[model samples]
Target: MVNISSCECMPWYVGVFRIRQRLTEEHWFDANCKYYTHVFDKTIISQVLGAIKYLSTIPKYEKCAKWLNENKQNLSQYFLEGFKSSKPLEVLIHGDCWTNNLLFKYNSKNTPVDLRLVDLQVSRLASPGSDINYFVYTSLTGDTRSKYFHDLLEAYYQSFSKVLILSRRKLPFTFKELEDDVERTKIVGLVIGLLAIPGIFFEGEDEIFDFGEMTEENMEEIFH
Candidate 1:
């Protein structure tokens, strides 16, 4: 379980970033353009579609495959809609919020005292939910995620609220509104998990394989 007080730093810092994003940029790049044309895009929708196509062929995840196929377009629309909402709750997201991106400094008693976030390569302006999705989904096991989902969200909200109060700015939305924003963009977690979880099992070394040297048989082995 995540202790609210210990983890308060995260949401408070996130709120600070959110305020910074609002003050500096009135608008972000178009979501569709970012999704499709950006060089480092690694388009989530496309990857999820590919994963769905591949996973559908396997028997165990047939239902997931079917849902992916049925909702693929809807999923894209949800992302686009999140971008289009009249009053978007936008923020500067850490982009890569997984455990590896955080460096912790511990106190004499070995309790965590401070944390520094590294890797700003993917930072962007987007819904706060996008950051939340990346952080929570990547860091927690599925069972823990399911069990403490609301508690985690509440912890974040409390910290965010405190930050807003300190900054002398009223929170733009209530906790209920935050919940709605999260629900609206829940597909981000789903698509990200589908595309990324497989890589977690890739237990190879850091050595790079030269695909240029591969023959047809090698290609088959690589794919399999």
Candidate 2:
């Protein structure tokens, strides 16, 4: 059974988690913008807020956040950084990429591989690395987090171009320019996703097993 609270949701991250699987294909063709029969669940959101706080306390996440804070003023600067770097080749990003639900039929022919992202729930306008980071973080876990973060980030920057340095990106005055946004964003996104742990998605019948018991403490964590 897939546990939602163990997954990602925050800054509307829960939307991706709450998305009903049956509609994934339809939404994919629509460029990933899909809403739901339900709105954000306060109970689920509570758990997420608490989780973000708890996960942020972990050293792996903290080290990443600390580095971000030391350089750029905050996380939002990433959007601008990406917009400036790309070769006018922007496409919708599968904003959430912890798992790739879409299946592909591979051909042995030496043709360019064109990926069709199956779930469009998290798809939104963003840079190349947006989907890339999600895949790498979830695909690689544990020590993989330690070893490949920098290398993966560097590759993404290189894929964009030589002059598109993250250093030129703008950020809040409270923070300075950071040397690396991709690396910092990668870990931060993953941790915050766990922090905003989403509610479970179920097919029907108000499955009791799907939802974890909601406590007032968890609620306070979310809206706080």
In candidate 1, stretches whose alpha carbon ends up further than 4 angstroms from where it belongs are 1-9, 34-61, 72-88, 205-224
lDDT of 2 at 214: 42
- lDDT score of model 2? 0.39
Q: Across residues 1-224, which tens digit of lDDT does each residue of candidate 1 receive?
A: 23333354566556566666655554455556642433212344455677887897888999888887777656655544543333447666776776667776777886766677789776767777767876777667777678677987887788777877888987877889878878877766775666456666567845334546756455444433
Q: What are the clash counts of all predictions, listed in order?
A: 0, 6
For candidate 2, the 10 contiguous residues with the lowest summed lDDT are 170-179
Q: How far is each candidate from the true structure, as Cα RMSD in Å? A: 5.4, 12.7
TM-scores of the models, in the given order?
A: 0.72, 0.38
Candidate 1 CA-lDDT value = 0.65
Q: Hey, what RMSD does candidate 2 come out at?
A: 12.7
TM-score of 1: 0.72
Q: Write the per-residue lDDT of candidate 2 for residues 138-219, one digit (tens) a residue.
A: 5555566566555554443343332222334322211111223344445445433443334333356653332355444554
Worst 10 residues of 1 by lDDT: 35-44
